[model samples]
Target: MKFFRNQIENKKDKSKKEDLAGASASASENYHSLLECLHHTGELKSQSLVINQLKFMLIYLETMADPEKIQKLILPALHKCMSLADLDECISSAGSVKTQSTREAADLLLEGYCLITVDTCSEFWLLQVRADIHRPPLEPENEKVVRGSHIGFVEDMAVNLRMIRQRMANKKLVFRYLTKGKETNTKIVLAYVKGIADEQVAETIYRKTEKIGADMIFSPGFMQEFMEEHPYSPFPQFLQTERPDRVMANLMEGKVAILAEGSPTTIVMPVTFFSFFQSPDDYNSRFLPGAFYRILRLISFVIALVLPSVYIAVIAFHFEVVPSDLVIPLKTSVSGIPFPPLLEAFIMVFTIELIREAGIRLPTPIGQTIGIVGGLIIGDAVVRAGLISNMMIIVIALTTVSSFSIPSVEMSASLRLLTFPLMILSSVFGFLGIMFGLMFIMIHLCKLHTFQSPYLEPVAPFTKTQYKDTFLRFPIRKQHKDKASEAGGNKANK
Candidate 1:
């Protein structure tokens, strides 16, 4: 208890920043001082001077949460007598992963989770309660590539941060934890390559991030929403991936990654458009196979986005271009069906969506069984009963399969929801309507910026050198397998 007191009396030079006391006390007075200052709230530009009012102190320390673990242990205020606290046990019981004592003495036994107290009774209790929650780890739902790492990001922040830290060997891979959400005190990590990441980008993150004052920064998705520069764009300007490999790749490219404490996925900023369609396996696998997968993903994206609208165009307005032989088969299938081509398409689309939603919301085993039965019984029974044409069934199936082909599940889901409007447009202006809609979407994408970089980087800006890693996975080194081994994965692809 006396150790901290001695250090405070003799150690501080009073020149550089000191842990200035809020009061000059008898050292016996009962007072509260905020401890283990994990974060700063209220104001960024506040004065650093300490105010001594009566017997109280509100000392602010750089290291807040677990104060005992701090490396430099010159506690000049340790001489005050108190009982030794089982602080670690209490904190762990409080459900935190690890807890460190903020101060040395037990009687003056106190650390500021919010405020630590001295000369007080033992009734001082801990503040802040965090419920551990996050999304489950699953395969990358949207950006699935066969050759990549299988695990996806879960909602737990610590777990997610660990995933990022595990990959990089460089100490320059830095993480700074900041607390936000005035009530929630939600933790967020700012990550970057100290040397590789642009200095301005880190500063920009710090500036914008500190301004956030939500009641509860509970979700990574929610935090990302508040912190990002643009809010209304239809296209995602940042790359939000659960895959650590993808994060490592972005780190290598000098991009910043932000992980909120509760969200399963972290977000990478200043993402180029070409980066969104990419998968980690594109760089991990052989170049030729990687290129093949990239082309497949690109094709799938194009199909998911435009196929139905194209179908509506051809069937409604370009039927004259259809060969006579195929037309008879199509006519025969729809012979008893009373609806127009557009109306029939709508009905089919609506039915498939209902089944998909049901499949996803239900439990896994039940959902799988339901999906099988729903697809077989519903589609086959309806066709057999002559309610809808066989050709209509085929179109809906193609759309569903193509929609799943997208790598990021969120993107796929977005594509699915967007298809209905495009379908309607196709019925109105045929291919021209689809073209108009697509052009508008593209403009939104190009206008979007992730962490100040062109969302469509390497494309909007047309960087030929950057393409060495985009779409096509080039070798780690042009010559020598030893160089490939030395460089780890393909540096160009990064």
Candidate 2:
């Protein structure tokens, strides 16, 4: 009986040893497979360590994972870890996840997570140690405002989301994450306020974003182009801004904001024509000043779009429309020029565009110097050579200044583009041509829809309630009262 008991106990111990051996072998195989699949990239790093008498491996991408974090947090935790439960307790990372599949573990490793493999354990522990790689959120040069929060969005998605959260501490603010770009696997976040944002609009944006089949989405512009309703339209369907306050304001108004990883620009959807003209400075100032500047910007838009065309029409066909006193001066200015008014305008406009392009491409101080010196030299030389008229130069300069007055760069660019068609029409058919071009533009604006919202809005669809905040901003107190009354009326109707 005693001999039989001893043999049975030995068999049981042998079985236990076999089970441990199998687990160890399986873990080792998985680790080797993961390494093979990840390939031998320069940034890929692996460290072997002995923890609590068990063989362990730490694998991560040096470019994506923070080395200091692994040293300070992960190494100490591993030393204290006697078992998986101890690891869970001792590791400081809140985003640690466990996976047994080699493929899943490899994916985690690429995403800046530190992967821990224990020789006798099938599961791999993923620790969040992503590198903090982004610049400080300094105010964007293009989106500068005279008054308001100077903070702007950074390239880091996590930091951008935190900025939004810090500004608007509302529970209703929701974020939906989606991955796009098969090759890039870029992270995208759709942010909107619940109950305020139209569910259909949000869903439309999400569906369009998810359906994109591109292999690489590097910037917000790429996503914007893919999701825009009117891809061919010169006007931007989405409002891209770097300011957090601007994004917050749009969110409050039931607009959706799309943020992409690795881009500082945020794309706001369903914006109207007036939205592009709006500046944070408008709201920061008193209602009167805000309204004045807003109206001025609108006027600037018209001038930027039609000023050159109007000049061409007047010079080529409608000399009578010019004030009798100024007609002589206009005639005198163009009399000595060799080119026709149309050619003259084109030359000056093209010259301005060249200077503008050069200025943008060069360093800041040098750019300003180039713009000023180049403009003066070129304008004087053209006028002296009689290739471009003095009057045409003045007109083109005014048009350029007017275009710059518009707050939105996209809209400003659109205006610059529209100028060419109108200039051609005005040169051939005079005022009638200008009128036809304006009519077509208005028709396009009215027909254009951004996510089913009228592009013109409040004006074309004629919403009386929205007028308070449209072209002319009413006093904040009065606007609030109107909103309250409007809400009350809505409730009563409901």
Poorest lDDT segment (10 consecutive residues) of candidate 1: 43-52
Candidate lDDT (C-alpha), each:
0.64, 0.88
* Model 1 segments more than 4 A misplaced: 1-156, 478-494
- Write candidate 2's Cα lDDT for 424-465 as tens digits: 999999999999999999999999999999999999999988
Query: Using alpha carbons, what is the TM-score of model 1?
Result: 0.70
In model 2, the Cα lDDT at residue 318 comes to 89
The top-ranked prediction according to TM-score is 2
TM-score of each: 0.70, 0.93
Top-lDDT structure, candidate number: 2
Output candidate 1 Cα RMSD.
11.6
Supply the global lDDT for candidate 2: 0.88
Candidate 1 residue lDDT tens string, 334-421: 7887777688788888888888889889998998888889889989888888888898788778888987766666667777777888
